[model samples]
Target chain A: MSRKIVRIAVPVLVLLFLYVPILILALYSFTDATQIGAIRSFTLKNYVTLFSTEELRSMIVGTILLALGAALLATILGTLGAIGSFYSRKRTSSAIATVNQIPVINADVVTGFSLCILLVVVFGVSKDSYIPLVVGHVTLCAPFVYLSVIPKLKQMDSSLYEAAMDLGATPAQALFRVVIPQILGGMVSGFSLAVTLSLDDYFIATYTKPATFDTISTYVVNATRGSQTDIKTALWALSTLIFVLVIVIVGVMNFNSGRAQKKEAEKA
Target chain B: MENNQNIIELKHISRTFEDGFRAVSDFNLEVKRGEFVTFLGPSGCGKTTTLRMIAGFDMPTEGEILLNGQDISKLPPNKRPINTVFQRYALFPHMNIFENIAFGLKLKKMPREEIKKKVKKVLELVDLEGFEKRSVSTLSGGQQQRVAIARALVNEPEILLLDEPLGALDLKMRKEMQIELKAMHDELGITFIYVTHDQEEALTMSDKIVVMSEGKIQQIGTPEDIYNEPQNAFVADFIGESNIFNGIMTGTMQARFAGGHFQCVDDVPEGTQITAVVRPEDIELTAPEQGQIRGKVISVIFKGIHYEITVQSGRYEVVIQSTKSAEVGSVVGMKVEPDGIHIMIAENNTNVFPVDMNRNHRLEFNGTELDTSLTQLIKGSRRNEEHELLDENGEVIDPEKIHIIASIEPQDIRMTDDVDDEQVLIEGTISNLIYKGDHYSYVINTDLGQDFIVDDEYLWNMDDRVGLILPLDKMRFQVKK
Candidate 1:
């Protein structure tokens, strides 16, 4: 009985430790409180300021667009790399797989600093062009996408590609028609991961972005250090909104996957 | 126009992998139009490799493949007018049955209505009518197999290559599909080239069967011809149950085997070394006094349609299949008709196997380390104290890069009854025996799946556990770069 109590108590304590701060901030976001440790009158003024501010709205839009573009590029490169490596000879494929893992396991700061050096110092590409920014994000995300896609390729029946070719489809046609659909699930998860990685990244963005541009992560850090209490409080509302969106998205994903698993079980 | 009947011809086709493992060697076959040709062999016998070469999935390392008298060896699978039904039904899981079947048609850019009509007709051909809208995952294995066949057939390929399409099916479903596929072939008049390890399936379906073993074709003949007239011990053993004995011609129309002299249909020069095959079903049991050879029934098994009896004579165990049952331990005489005996010239009486040179310059074969040196493999080469072999010019020879083949005459290897004897180099079971005039040639199969042929003047009973002693002086080694 005590062992069972420990098990339940431990997990509850850990979860509480993780969510308590976020819950407190969410609760405060709904009020007109200027600071924590004090309760002010209930109001939607923080949310109103969060949406009405032109600077915050543009920065959020710019960050989202950057993430979308980078994730798209990363997904294509990663999927193609995975398919190419999977079809290569054993030695070449394993060598490619090993090389692809280095970026995934390396420190993000190191990756960002090196990209900054390579693009700014060696190649002399202008930082204002946003090429280095997109390249850094793709470098950070593509390896992760490749890692996620390889298992799906391994799970797929390899003969399906040959079957398509035998049925008179060209190699490219077989790849697109038979191979891509089977690995689409892995690609989707990889794309979402790339997007999340791009959004969460701060060092790479800071190193590579233009001096005038600011992502949410950089803006939040700058905003907290500034003396503007209104914008700071508005950030609480933004954080609350992002947290709620994540919860809804995760919930829908779980529901969809559960239904898919149930359908697979029924088919079997 | 006389050559028009041959739709596809493989001339000296060979496929050696990058790692130097030969999958198919010098394979040649002429497949006639509308002919149901089957390549029959055990797994890793180059049957599927040959099929893949014909299907354009694999390219041969040497030789050309002619499709309607035109070389298509370098053509890709899509460019070739051939389709293959894979062993596992490789249906597109994301597509519905209709879309899967119409994939080739869509690639060809056929009209949508015609694609549908063709899909429907092929689906009915495979007995999967009205299954167009069903998703691939919703179908059973057999249903998916039909969909695969329908997908391949809907394109109406000039040649249909089946690589063990029914290998995944259960016995009953396999039997059913065999008949259905044969009927489909007959109705369509399409040339079918099939690869299978199952001999019964080949016999039941094929018009011509190519028996292959170890990347080489052992024999190519009709099913009746393959069964009744096997060309070698491998074919005799693979095609069906047969008692193969190494015999010698004593006189005209007379051969001596299994401790008995019998008249055979084959006429060879007297004293010629030969291997005789007698099928189990062709041997008749008679009273001991009236039989050509007398033996005691060691075991009897009821085999659904016949009783299979194993009779132990002096040094041989003869398998006989008959409708009548025999009591175990009862004496019986076995008589074989003259036409029942198939005579084949004995293959080379030497056992040759590939061996690797170890770091110590010793030879290794089939997990057994032999007391042979790499220096002995090359003439005028000697191993130094550092274990490196040096040639006559004193240049070091890399043992790792060299390929060593060891060959020993059958008579140079002796077998001992003590299986656990440490002095012996290998231990095996006596799988087969043939009496060749003054000596008995035995096929000893080791647990490692290597067969070593040895000839001894002394008689040994079949299935006797024995250890082989290879005399080093009598063993010859060949070194290849």
Candidate 2:
């Protein structure tokens, strides 16, 4: 019992050690209305100032649209790739799997730097365009989607596809009706991963992203660098909203998948 | 099912893989309407290949496949009036039982109401009606198989092809499904082309059995016909346990075997090699003096319903089964009626030429001039190896070129305690003896990996080196036309 308590204690101590400053920042965001050492009372001015600025709203909308679009695309592509490779012969599949892991293996700073050059030099596209932002985000986020989907696809039973084919379905029909539906659990996870990765990606987005494109991450980074104390509380408010929405989506998808699986089991 | 109504006919069908290995060749079969025909063979015997050809999954390299006299070789699987139930019942994991059964019907664009009714009726037929809305992932294996069957049946194809469909099921489940499938066959009256390696399954479920090996049909007949009247030694030995002996023709109706002349029923010409088939059930055991042939009981095994006794006479091991048990050490006499004798030409056709195999496995045909390859080798030798039996050396002889001879009865070869330089045959003991319900198989421990499979009524024990009997009837005409 003492050992169990000790095991729990070390990790908690480490977490507290790391999160103390974040906790302080969160508290300071509400009270940073006046200069330091005064230690003035809490106010919502910083939070209110964020809402009052039209640019903040535009940046949030842009960030949300870019993240959602890239994440959704990457999720579908990764899932299809994973499921496809799962059914294929080992050598061809291994080659494709190697390609899927390339994004993660490449250093993030290097990828951001290289993509910045490619977008501006090769495509000659403007740096601040939403296309560059979405492109950069998808490049950074797709590997996470791939990583999430591959495990689920690997765990799937191959006999199910054979069963479907033997029962009079064409190869194409089997892929859609049997293969895709069976691995949809993986699809939700892959989507979540891509979305989360896209929402958090700033290094790549900041480098090649359009001038007007300030995702939540870039906006916060810029706001902090510029010493704009007004938007600090609003950043917290925004993080909480994103966290809540992600939780709701995850819970709903999980519940939906569970129910569907139960129904399938009963029918089977 | 076999009353001259041909439903599917395979004419001169041959299948050779791209690697140039022939899996099946010149396979011909005519399936009567609604008949349950089984393709039974050991692994790599082209039985599954034959089934696949019928299902349109594979095309024959030569000749045509006709369905009801209409050529259907060019048709794809779905276009053909047939459906296959695979070894693993491929149930759709995503679809419920109702949707799975209805899938084919939906493809046909049948009315929604009609599809629903058909699906419901088929589900009821498979005893899974209430499971229409339940997902496949939740069902037990048997239930899933039924769903697969229902899925195929709902398509209402004229024929059903099952490739070892019960292979994956447990023994008990397999037995149950066999009965269920047989019942389903009767109820539906659709032609079933079932492929299986299990001889018992073939015998039980099939109206006709096609025994195949090495891409060729060994025999095609009813179960009774196959068991009672085997065409060759392979067929006889394959269908049931058999005690085989070789005897030289003493007269047109007589054979000289084991230093005894017995009255035989075959009409082989004088001087030709002959094979004798003795089924175990025909050999009656009796008291030592009263029996026609006397031997010592070497082994005894208890079957669920009968007792199997093995006896050794000189070098021969004869196995006999009876409801009554016999003491292992007792000496017994055995009796076989003249009518129990089966004679055939003692040779098995093989693709392997005699020259390529090891000398220890060599076979002796009466004459060697008939094989073109052998003739060519003999004509080409620089310093000719002696043809030992020839009076004068007209051509070269190579030990590698000699053919491997097959005797009619494995029991005809008598074992010897010592190898005399003049004696070409080797010595061995009864390493393993099996009493099949109908015959006994004895594996001689030649220790050369060339252990011989001999059949006889004499039951022998392990570690006994008995004289090998090369009965006169086991000799064969070396020439092939």
Candidate 3:
């Protein structure tokens, strides 16, 4: 009984350590605080101001669009690369996989700085272009997609493709009908990982973005640093909203999975 | 034989993998329509390779495969009118049972209604009619097997290949499926080519059995022929329990071995040497005065139907299966009828010598000319003095020359019993002694840089120096091209 209490208590303490500050920040969204360190009176004035402004809302939209675009492009390219390399010769595929892992394990600042040099100094990319920013996001996200997809490919039965072909399907038909459906779960998980990573990124975005285009992370950093305007409480509202959305999504998935298990048990 | 009646013919098929492994060698067979044939062997004996070649999943490295008299060796599996039930079933987990069975017809662009009708017909044949809507993963192993069969049968191929299809099921389920598969085969009346290593399964289900070992077919015959009339030592030992004795033909229908002379039913000439095989059930236990040989019982095992008894006679232990139980350590006399003894010419001995007879009536062998009578060289040959070893139609024997192959049986090479004489052909030290069920087979490395296998009824210690005696009648010669 004491051991079970320890197991339960350890995880609870860790969750509190991770989430207490986020909870505090969420509570600050309703108050009229001028800075993160100072407590202030609770008010709805910040929400009203946040809605009245178009720039902040546009920043949020821009960040979302960029993340979605990056995830879409990365998933397609990464899933294809994963399948192609799986059929390639063993030595070449392992070499390619090793090169794919460098960006994932490397420091974000190093990756961002090198990509900046490659786009601006090496390729003569202009400062106001979105190409550099979009390319940078795709580059940062594709490796995570590759990591997710290759394991699923390896887990699939190698004979399934031959079995399909033996059953009168051609090579291309077998690939599309049998192989792709088997690995779709891995591709989906890879796409979600890409999107999450893109949304949380600051260094790569800052290095590649033009001065006129401000993402949420860049806007928040710039807003808090200068005296032109105080950091808005609307940021806290956005954080709390995202936290609640994640919790709801997780709860729904768990409930559905449990119900599926019950149905299968009843069936058997 | 009508050409149309032979559904598939493999002519000199050989397969050598890229990794220097010879999986099958010079395999040839003709499968008649509506016949159930099985290739039975231990693992890596090319049984699966042969079945795969017939199904077009694997192509022979060299040779021709004819399906209905047309060469189908170069065709792909889909192009051939053959379907295989893989060892693992290989059912598509992503599809329901209905879609899985309909996949082939759907590819052919058959109408939906017609495809459904055909799939239902096959499902009923396999006794899986109501399993259409269930997911493949939800079904049991036996059900999955039936689905695999139904999927293949629905295609309506000319021939069906099964590669150890029941290997994954439990013992009881496998037995049930075996009966079901045999019944299905009878109803379909399609040619079935099955591959397995289980002798009992092969004997139970097949109309013909091809026994193979080391990538070569040992014997091909019906189940009764393969079990009762095995052609060689390997076949006799593999098919069932047999007590093989090294014997010499003493006279017409008589052989001498095991320190006793017994009457046999073989038609070999007198003074010829042979190996005799007798099944365990063929031996009779009787009184000492009424028996041919007597020995003490070594072990007795109570098998369900019979008592298996091992008797030690000299250095050999002979196993006998009888309905009457015999006490262990009791002395017993054993007798066998004349028909119980099967004599076969021993083949493929290591002590091989090339011999040829000249027109001058002299034999040249091993760089020595021997004065053997010419009558023995050409005796019982198809080509006698008139053809001079040529065919009767004057078609020269390939090179228009006669060559002879002479082999000395290892068991016939006797060691001198503490006496050295001019008949000592070789002196060697015993290198290894392996206790084959009936006798001790010894490997001897001689001073002349040769190895000889000798089956003896007397125990000899390893590394013992012994002089070998090759009896004149034991050295049998056969005509070769």
Candidate 4:
């Protein structure tokens, strides 16, 4: 009985440790407290400021746009890379897999600095253009997409492509009609992962974004370092909103996967 | 050219993989229009490879493929008038049955209404009517197989290639599918090229059967001809149950084997080495005195329709299948009519036996340890410091997985009159002999029932006891992976 208590208590403690700070911030965002030390009466003032402020709104919108664009590009490139490698010869496929692993394991700072150097210094591409920023995020997210897609490709029946060909579909038709649908689930998950990764990234955006524009991550870092009390408190509301959005997304994904599993079991 | 009845012809086709493994070699076949030809062989015997070549999925490395007298060797699969039903029923899981069947029709830009009608008609052909709009995962294995066949047949190709399409089904379902598929073939009258390792399925469904072994065709004939007159020992053993014995022609119409003389129908010259084949069902059991050869019944097994009996006569075990039952341990006489025996000139008169290799890389034959090492079995293979055999890739090969067959030519074996000689490996009685131009070929039957065909220059009397001297240098070993 004591052992069971430890097992339950251990997880409860760990979860509390991880979520207490976020919970405190959310609670404070509802109150008129400018700082965490004191909690005043409840108000919607912080949430109003978070939406009414033009800089914060544009920054959030720009960050989402950047994430969507980068995630789209990353999903395409990564899916193509995975499919090409999956169909290649054994040696070539394994070599490509090994090469794709380096970026996934490498430090984000190194990738950001090297991409900045390659695009902004040697290539002389101006920072005023957001090319380096989008390239940096795509580089960061594409390998992860490839990693997600490889497993789905491996799980799929390898003969489906041949069957399509045997049934009079051309090579491209087979790939688009038969092969793509089988791995579309992985591609979707990979796209979502890329969006999240781009949203959470700070170092790559800081090094690569245009001088005049700012993403949420870069703006948050600058905002936290300033002495603007009102804006700081409003950021709390933004964090709460982001956290709620994440929870909703994760819950929906889990629910969908669970339903899919149940359906599969019923079919069997 | 347009009036030719041959649908597809494979001319001297060979396929060698990148790793130097030859999957098919010098294969040639002409598939007549509307002929239900089956490529029958054990797995990895190039039957599926040949089928793939015909389906335009694989290109032969050496030869051309002709479709209606036009060379289409380099044509893509989509360009060919062929469709294949895969072994695993590779149906699109994301699609409904209607969409799956209408895929090829859609590619051809057929009208939507016509596509639906065609799908409905083909589904009816496969007896899967009213299955449209159902997801693939909701179907049973047999149902999925029917969907696959319907999907292939809806295209109306000139030829349909089926690569063991019923291999995944249970026996009863497979039998049902076999009859249904044959009926479908007859109704459609389309050419069908099938690949299967099951001999019974091949014999039951095919108009022409091509038996293959080790990337080569052994025989191509009708089912009746293949079962009645197999060209080689491989075909004879693979097609059905037969009692094959190493024998020699004693006279114009007589052959001596299995320690007894019997009259055969083959008109081979006297003193010629031959292999006599007698089907199990052709042998009749009788009283000991009224039969050609006598033996004691060792086992009697009741099959569903007949009784299978094994008789041990001298150093031979003859298997006989009959409707009547026989008492085990009772002596009985077995007789084969003159026309029941099928004889062929012996292809290889060498003595070959399976040998095992121990961890120490020593060769073991018939449970007796020999002085030969495992490396001697395969040339270019060497033993490492740990006494494990290393293949050409320097990889340690498992001794148990390698099938080692040691063979000694008839000319390489020496017979000794002294049964207790030190160099003698086995002692046996002289069962049969054939006189060649300058030498004599003898079949020695050991007590373990193994036959050793040896070529000797001197004369040996009948029933004389002799010991075999297998010289170490004269024996050749082959390793089958």
DockQ of each: 0.73, 0.29, 0.30, 0.64
Q: By lDDT, who's the top model here? A: 1
Candidates in order, interface RMSD in Å: 0.7, 3.4, 1.9, 0.8
* Candidate 2 CAPRI classification by DockQ: acceptable
Model 4 sits at an interface RMSD, in angstroms, of 0.8
- Residue-by-residue lDDT tens digits, candidate 3, B1-481: 4534989999999999875677999998999998999999878789999988887777899999999899999987778778888888988878999999998889889999999899889999988878889998889999999998998888888899999999999999999999999999999888899999888999999999999975789999999999888887777877778887767889999888766689988888987767788899999987766778888899999999999999987766788999999888888898999999888886655577666666543565533455454444655434556644444464434432677777887778788645366667667887656455566777677765567778786889978988777676778777774
Q: What is the Cα-based lDDT of residue B130 in candidate 2?
A: 81
lDDT of 4 by residue, A1-268 (tens): 9999999999999999999999999999999987888775999999999999998899889999999999999999999999999999999999999999988899888999999999999999997999999999999999999999999999999889988888888999999999999999999999999999999999998888899889888888898899998999999999999999999999998999999899889888
Full candidate order by TM-score, most accurate first: 1, 4, 3, 2
Runs of candidate 3 exceeding 4 Å displacement: A1-9, A37-39, A43-59, A76-104, A108-143, A146-158, A203-232, A260-268, B1-4, B246-248, B257-259, B269-275, B349-435, B438-481
Q: What would the per-residue lDDT of candidate 4 be over residues B207-289, giving only the tens digit for each residue?
A: 99999976889999999999999997778878888887778999998999877788988899999988888899999999999
TM-score of each: 0.88, 0.75, 0.77, 0.84
| Index of the highest-TM-score prediction | 1
Question: Which one is best on DockQ?
Answer: 1
Candidate 1 structure quality by residue, lDDT tens digits, B16-94: 9998778899989998989999999978788998998888889999999999999999999999999889898888889
Candidate 1 wrongly placed segments (more than 4 Å): A1-4, B1-4, B352-407, B411-469, B473-481
What is the descending lDDT order?
1, 4, 3, 2
Clashing residue pairs in all predictions, respectively, total 1, 39, 0, 0
- Lowest lDDT 10-residue stretch of candidate 1 chain B: B431-440
List model 1 lDDT by residue over A1-268, tens digit each.
Answer: 9999999999999999999999999999999889997885889999999999999999999899999999999999999999999999999999999999999889889999999999999999998989999999999999988988999999999999999998888899999999999999999999999999999999999899999899999999999999999999999999999999999999999999999999989988
Q: On residues A33-105, what C-alpha lDDT tens digit does candidate 2 reach at each position? A: 4333455788766667667889898888887788789988788777777777776778889998898788888
Expressed as tens digits, the lDDT of each residue in B1-481 for candidate 2 is 4556899999999999775767899989899998999998877778888887877777888879999899998776657768878777766656777888887787677999999889889888888868878877778788878888888888888888888888888999999999999999999999898899888888888899998876889899998877766776667766667766555677878775543456667787766666667777777888988766788899989997888888887666677888888898998888777877677766632212221322322234322222223332333333334433221354433455444434344645555555453343446666555553234566675533345666655567766775454544454334322
Task: Rank by DockQ, highest first.
Answer: 1, 4, 3, 2
Docking class of 4: medium
